[model samples]
Each structure stands twice: as C-alpha cells, then as structure tokens.
Target: MKKRFRSTNPVVVGLATGLYPFLYNYYSNFTLVDSLGQLCFFVAFFLLVPVAINICIKIASKKIPFVAKNYILLLTLSNLVGFASLLTFSILGPKKKIILLVIVLVFLLALLLKKQLKKIIFLQYLLALIVAFQLGFYIINNLNFSTQWKQLPDTILEAKFKKKPNVYIIQPDGYANANMLKKPPYAIDNSAFENFLSENNFKIYPNFRSNYSNTVTSNSSMFAMKHHYYKNPKPSSKEAFGLRKSIAGNNATLSIFNENGYKTSLLIESPYLIVNRPKLGYDYSSIAYNNLSFLSRGFDMNVNVVAEMEKAIVANKDQTNFYFVEKILPGHIPVSKSGSEGKEIERENYIDNLEKANVWLRQMITLITENDPSALVVIVADHGGYVGFNYTGELKRKVKNATLVNSIFAATLAIRWPNNEVPEFDTDLKTNVNLFRILFSYLAQEPTYRNQLEDDGSFLIVSQDVPFGVYEVIDGNGTFVFNKVSF
Candidate 1:
C-alpha cells in the first residue's frame, strides 16, 4: 500500500493564523467586513510563514530535525508576550487586586498547559482563536465612537431685542445625566455639579440628551450644526452629508467657524487629534499645552483641561475665539479611593477619576469666567457611562456590552452665553443637537437652519450597540425613549 500523506489540517492552520487578525480587528472595533478580511490575511500569513521557514531549514540542514518543535515554541512564546502586553496596556490601572489575581491565574494556566500546548494542534488553534477574538473585540468596541449636532437658521430675527453672544463648546467625555447614575459604590453626586453650575450663573438643562453616545460623533455634530443618525447602509459616495460623512470626509467645526471669520482653536485633552489624522480647518490650532503627562500617562485628565483653557484664553485674549474643549474628567470608569477593596476596586477607581475631573472642571470654569465673562460657554457630556451592567442578562447583554453601555447620568448641558443672555429654559425639551442649533442661532443671529429642530422638541440619543432603545430627555426627565428598530 502507498504511504498516506499526513499533513496539517487546513482548518486548524487557517484558524490559528486568522486568530491574530480576528482578535486585533475585533478589539479595534473594525466593521464586520474589515474584521473578516483581516482575519483571512493573518491566517494566510501564518500558514505561509511556516512553509517558508520549513523550506529554508531544509536547504540549510538536510535533517531539519527540530523545525516543528521550534515552530510550536515560537507560537507559544508569541501568545504569552501578546497577552502580557494587552494586560499591561488595558485602561484599567494595575492597582486593582482583582485584575492582578486574574493575571496570575492566566499565567498559572499557561505554565500548566505548556507541554500540551506545544503538542496539541487543535488546542493551539483553539487558544489562538480565543486570544484573537478577545483582543479584537476589545479594540473594536473601544474604537466605535460617534457624535452629532443640528444647524441653526441663517438669521435670528429675535436678536433685535436680544444681545448677540459668544459661544463656548465644552465637551466632557463619558458624562451622563445625574438622574440615571445607578452604578453601585460610585454613583455621581449631581449636587456638586449642580452647585458648580449655580455658582457660575449657568442654566442647566435637566433633560438634555446627547445625539450620539461618543465624543467624535456628538462633538462633530455639535460643531457642524447637523443632526446625525447612524445609518449602516453604505453612503453613495464619501461626500455624503451627516455625521458619517463628516468623519469620512474629515470635516471639522473649526472649518465652518473659520469660514464665517471666527478665530477657531481646539483645547482637546484626548489623543484623538494627536494621532495626526486630517482635521478640517484649524489655521492656528494650539494643542500643545494640553499634551502634558501626569500619573505617567501621555495626558493628565485631572489637569489638562484647566491648562488648555488657560492657554486658549492667553492666546485669544483679544480675538473672538470659538474654543472647542474636550475635558477628560470623571472618565467612564468611576472608581472611588475609599472603595478600593475587593470587587469594588474598579468602581472606586472610576469614581476617583471622576472626582479629579470635577476638580479640573471647576478650575477651568473659574479661569474662563475670570478671563472672558462674555464668552458663551456650553458644557455637556460626550456620552453616558458603561458601568454596572450584568453582561449575562438577556435584555442588557448582547454580543458585547454595547447595548448596556448607556452613560451613568445625563450630562450637565449647561450654557452661559455672552452678555448674560439666558434663553428661556425649556425644561420639557432637550437635545444636544438643539443646543448646537441654539448656540449658532445666537452667534449667527439666524433662525435654526432647516427647521432641523425636531417637532417633539426632545433629544434623541442613539448607538449602534444599543439599537432597541433610545435615551430621550423630555420635561426634565432623563428616561429611555423606546424605538421599534432592532439590529
């Protein structure tokens, strides 16, 4: 009988190779199609690399006795290093005991299975798939961000009696309404936020809801003066209008303001702008002051905003400045220092971050008010928090925690326009999109463009992760606005 050919299984090889790309894409929040394509590419590479190495070994040494052993060892070591790196880079600080314990357990398991891991082809493939999927998911979800805003009319006829005002757009990442702050051990205390607002002569919108649950999308919409809905259907071309279009086209609010002759400057705390992607129209952008390190990170959430605002004020002391500032306060993870014991450590850390953020906000506000009392300042959250959800729960959980990731509280969308002109506080109506429209109305002396303002006079908050429900603000109540759409 002819000797049977014994070769590695294609499925095993493909899966093993694909795992790296799959995990990377998933964690990086790649679209479905892109993730799959990456997976195929990685798999092909993994299979081909081994073949190439084997051929080289045969040419160099006729026997090539330990090629398989070397390959297995290489794969195993790479996995160990990759996982270790991931743990190192996770936003969750290393101080958490639970995280440390998990790391220890993972290390022990890796060591225990070292022998089997090297020999079992199927197991190796399975391990690769699991790691790739987990890492990919992490990257993808984190990267999936969005923002929106509506246009004001070309002219505000009511301005004859009202004062023309300067506008300030303040975006606090991961801020939500105080009413829905339900995460345990670190729920937000609106009293402090309220106190800050009242002291600053600010008008707080109790019912304001963000248009989208992300900084980039909501901020883009806010600046662009456009209402954006997440539409999965591919746009006809890259030039399409909407939030998707703005991001795809690299449009920025600075461009619009610059066109209208307002000097524009960005005081952003996040690294989004630093990644060196093309941002629209910033002839004199000053982002250096906020790019300092604190607590060993690239940017210190606690002090960056205050510093950036001060710098902006100094730079635009004489100019009518349209300052776009994104404050990284009270980050989504609310961890209190007092509660850093046992399972409560994560929560405590998150709260600690928020408290630091609040401190920064207070300082920034004081500086702004002192420097430019006539500036129109609007403070709002980019999106709600993603905390305290039972991922296993049927209604709350999905492929990921995307649906349950609503912010802890509605953001404090408070506005202090120039000339002490406070628009009638419509407690019954709220929308971040409308806030942009209203601000532009005051700035441009025009009616809200397109009547783009919703008839319901309420804000609509949507997310791709959470398709079944919409968070709406009406009559000063922050509640879920149910929609029939299912994804």
Candidate 2:
C-alpha cells in the first residue's frame, strides 16, 4: 500500500467539505448569525469528524498486524465520502433511493480524476481563488454601503403634524390591483373584499401600482418615498445591499412617525423580511420566525397576525400608534409555471390564496374597527400576484401581452381615513412609492409636502430579457409605457 496521500490536497479537501454550507449562506445573502452558524457546522463536520476518524484509523493500524500502516489515505478518502454524501443530500433532498446513484457518480468521478490529477489540482486552485474573491468583494461592498446607500429626502422629516390619529398600514403580500383581479388568469370576483372596504368608507385606488415588482424593492421604495431603481449593486444575484436597511432601520416613514409622538409597532406573519434582523425602528415587534436563532424553523400563518396586532394595539392604545402588519397571504407561487398544466395549477392556487386573503382582510378590519373605530387604516399590497407567471423572473419572457405585464406591477391600495378626511393629494396617489408621502401630508395637514412627492413612475427588473436593466412599465399618468430608465 502507498504511504503517500498526494491525491487529496488539504485546501481542496476543505473547500469540498464546506461547499454546501458556503453555498447556503451565499444564497441567504450571508445573514449574520445564520452564516456564523453554518460556519460552525462546517468546521465540526469537515475538521472534527475527519480528526476523529483519523484517530480511529491510527488506533486500528497500531493494534492489528494486517492493518495498513498508511492511514492518511484512509482519512482523505473518508473526507471525500463525507463531502459527496452531504452534496448529494443537499441537491436531491433526503431520499434513500438516491444513495445508490450518488455512490455510482462519486465512483465514476474518482476514476476519471485518477488519469487527470494535475488538471484537477489546477481547477481546484482556481475555484478556491474565485470563492475568496467573491467573499472579498462582498466585504468591500458592505464597507462602502455608508456612501452608496440612498439617503432619505429632507422633505419627509421636515413636516409638522397636528392630527395624531392611530394609523395602521396592513400589507397583504402579492394581492393584485382591483382592475387586474378582474382580468385574465386571476378573473377573481374580489367584489366581496372591495365592497367591504367601500362600506367601511375606504377609498380604493383601482389603478394603484407598485413602484417595483418585487416585495423588498417595492416596500423599500414605499417607505423611503423614492424610486431606488435597484441601484444598490449586489455582489451576487441573491444578495441585496441596502433594501433591508431602508425597509427596517433608517426608514423615512418610521423616522417621521417616531419623530412625531406616535409609538410605532411592526407585526409580521413571516420572517421573509426580518429574518436577518436588520436594525428595527419599531417600538414593538412580533415576528413569525426567530430572527436571533439560526436553526429556527417553522412560521406562524396569517391567521395569527390579528392576534399579534390586537396585542400591539392594546399595549399602545394611549399613544398615537403607527402599526405595520404584514401578512404573507396570497403570496406569489414559489416556482415558475412553464407548461400549460403547471400554469393552470398555479392560477388555481393563487385564487385559493386570494379567497383566504379576503377572509383575513375582513377579520383584520373587524378587529381594528371594534378596537379603534376612528383609526386611519391603509390596506395595501407589496406587489401583484404575478398570476400568469408564478415567479417575477418568469415575466421576462412570459409577458407577451399587456395584461400579463400589468399583472406583475399592479398592487392594491385602499385607505380608510378617519372621519372620511381625504386630502386633495389622495387623488394623485397612483403608486406605492408616493403612498406615505400623501399620508404624511394628510396627517401633517401640510399640503406643501405633497409638492415634494416622487413621480408615480413604476419600474421593474426583468432578468433573461433583451434590455437587462430597470424598465419603466407605468408612467406617472397611469399610462402603460415601456421605457428603459436612464438613471
């Protein structure tokens, strides 16, 4: 038996052993403590397990006369097996039937690499450099965020408020606008929900569209009251540089509310936004998933959102409250529907969720009315359902008609003002980017703030398309115009 273990370079072995965890963290945008947890698991699995196995091999080699004196090769082979097993599980999920396939593939790969060992070594070094460069770039990008992050416009914090009504901004994820609901794929009879809002003296903006097609981008723009145009350049496709910070920490809307005498509270049904635990500005928060724990699993459904809201409302009833309740009802389908059968299934699922959303809306409205009847309630959506396409990226090619394109950007915005005190600027509220600007103006009784409101131009990023940049899908005058954004 050969005593030398030249085939397994420790750097290559380490990288192979830790690839799955690294990829997971990379995809998750390097969520702080979660990434740290993954690192810990990597160390234990890659280093500790191999060390223990090597110790056992050493012991066996000494005790048994026939045992191979060279244990380094055995240790290296064990590392390869561990890496292969983990990768196979990560890709194909936990299925016993796939084990034989994984073993066969690993055997074939080893045989091919035996003849081309030098080439394989060169490739491994190259991959290591690539991984290191990516990490370095991400670090540099984050360090520059202070200079690159979009600063909140001065107008938002300059306003003076006289009225201190309890304001509630309830966001239902992926609920299509009233017009789009009646259109194709969705053709939903959402009249019940609309009528309920109407009866409650809510002004439904039928043409209200989102400034951006995706949730993080749309809400970030809405809170900042400005179009970011996805300008915060990311190191990777899955990573977003400043959107979460804008949505949570340095939020202009939250700053305005806090600067005034209002006690702000945020209650979310899922951890999609708060999973990384960005510096939250709210005085009180009830999140569905544990932001602090990396291994935290499962999440409370939208049904529990009202209970949390009720608690928050009761706790801060004496002060002027600004509550943001985000419910993940009628959320966009997880996967893109490529075939006709898949698309039809996705449509049915979307409608089912929509129906569930209606029920939740009524429940939420009832809860609010019973507790605080004179409160200003704004029921809005983050973005449209993307009904024709399950996912937003699918719209790049699937948006063949106007209806499909509109469905991707159209979002619901309905506000029930206290004593029906609708401001003149309310009529001009066409997109969510200008949503808070109009509301703050109404609260401040300062019509001048409306003058500084951002243009109601809706923008979206469509990957795998001809012009791969932010496209202005809807103009300020509620007109559908496809123009690539210059800035």
TM, every model? 0.58, 0.81
Residues 1-487 of candidate 1: C-alpha lDDT, one tens digit per residue: 1211122332333334334433543343333213233345434444454444434533444345575445444343334433443334333422446556655666666555545543544554566578666655544443333432233344432233133334567777776565545433336565876777777888776646666545555655555555544332221111112343353223444455555656766666654433222333554444442342211222323336567667767876765667667777655642343433433454565567677767777887888888888777878886655455321122222222222433433455777756666645334236565555555445555554335554332233333456433333332243344442322
Weakest lDDT window of 10 consecutive positions for candidate 2: 294-303
Against the true structure, candidate 2 reaches a TM-score of 0.81
Error of 2 at 135 (Å): 5.1
Candidate 1 has an lDDT of 0.49
The Cα error of candidate 2 at residue 389, in Å, is: 3.1
Strongest candidate by lDDT: 2
- Model 2 alpha-carbon drift over 4 Å, by segment: 1-16, 19-24, 27-78, 81-126, 134-149, 232-239, 288-292, 295-303, 335-341, 398-400, 463-465
lDDT of 2 by residue, 204-301 (tens): 98888888878788998888888777773332444345576677666888888988978888877765666555667777767633443333222322
